[model samples]
Target: MHLPSRPDLTKSVFGPQSDFIAVVFSPVLAEWDEGAFCMPLLDLLVARGYQVHVYDSLSLAQESSTLHATSENWDAYLRANYPQIDLAVGQAYGGALVNSLLSGFLKTCPRVLGLSAPTRCSAELQSNLASILTCLDMQGETAALDLLEYYVKPERNDKYQPLPPTKVEESGIGQRLRIGFSQLMKADARSHVNNYAGHMLQIYGAASRLVNTDSIVVSSDNRRQISSGISGCGMRPVIEAPEIALRLISDFLD
Candidate 1:
């Protein structure tokens, strides 16, 4: 895979050559690097002829006082850098960021896609995540990984194979995770969804422990409320069913 350079707010430019321009946001604890977990999705989009721009929410969060502020900053960044967006795709915490900014995007982007996205956060979920982070800080990566496995409840499938163990000791990873969780806790995407007048396809893991599948689904009122569209699908986690997830994304993009 050909990896793009890290996003520079002042120096980076979205190329003018591709037919489609996609801005993808990475989940918490993940960066837009060669080893990024979302590389497969990026590679697939590139192969499909998109000029893809990737951003890491953790980095974005570091620069802002609040997640909403971060979303606004990103909105400005997109408007300043890209002529227009063909599609927007985000996963996990990235999905939440996309949701938070969906209203502003509706004017320039026609379609949006969210994978394992959550629309609302409950106190229980917040508490659980806090516990996970505490484990990361006190007991280290091993404990955190164990707790993460418990939360994700990953399953093996033909299309979704287990990934090799990753080292979680990277600098600032823990801080990013904390910031991501805090942002998620404060995120409320209902207003954005209600205001967006464009096509949206929200996909979630039927078995996902992190996000409540019901909260993210587009309600009938939302379907009628949106100007362009609202739709959704549920499947196994991407890591447990990559082919299914990829196919869903391809179909939506096509």
Candidate 2:
């Protein structure tokens, strides 16, 4: 499939702003549903005097024709365009993507804010993440299907709660369908845990250790795997994700 030209986000939504923040949303995992996960953050950022750029990972993946884009492509996009993004933020799958982008694309930005970023994304450093991806992708097709049934379908009709009622009004037929399936087939949480866990753990661990202002970590009420002692290494408790997400980005952008 031919990828659409990069949407004219800056001109169409942000007006003409030299310095702005990019608010990339996470791949809506199947069980969690859509609109429920991302819209709250958009509201918070808009209230902050920041021009937020929202990228649906699902839409980009379909157009890009890849379940996921590696950090290299993300970096190249930044270097080639939108390099002026002063700060980048996201959560869960989205968090992983932004971290990957910054790992490759960061130039002068002072901070990157991440919510519920799995330590496994830096697995090479965090030995605990060794099995992360395998656990997720072992049953790839089924997992994908589960995602579709839960989030994508509901998004189509605005049947899911926790989303603002206004959501039904804003999302058109096409976008709802596009968002639903994109979330389903693009990538699995486990696979993401595998590919980037080690790298992410090391990166965030280093940032924490170094007290780097360029990176910060926050998580929804989702508790880490206490048994394994990998605090912050599992699915974010779905309920708290939206609020925690908003706070992290707001502070980072401000």
RMSD of 1: 6.8
Model 1, range 1-254, lDDT digits (tens) per residue?
Answer: 11123355312124445878887777775234532556667777777888777666655466326778778767777666667888887777888888888767444478788777766665655676787777777766656656755665532342423233454554555666667876777777877776677777776655455665444745455453221111222222455566777777777777
Q: What TM-score, over all chains together, does every model reach?
A: 0.76, 0.46
Q: Ten-residue segment with the worst summed lDDT in candidate 1?
A: 226-235
Q: Give stretches of model 2 more than 4 Å off.
A: 1-19, 28-36, 58-69, 122-254
Cα RMSD (angstroms) for every candidate in the order listed: 6.8, 11.9
Top model number, TM-score:
1
Cα lDDT tens digits for candidate 2, 53-102: 65544434333333245444455555666646654555545655564454
Name the 10 consecutive residues with the lowest summed lDDT in model 2: 224-233
* 161: Cα error in model 1, Å: 22
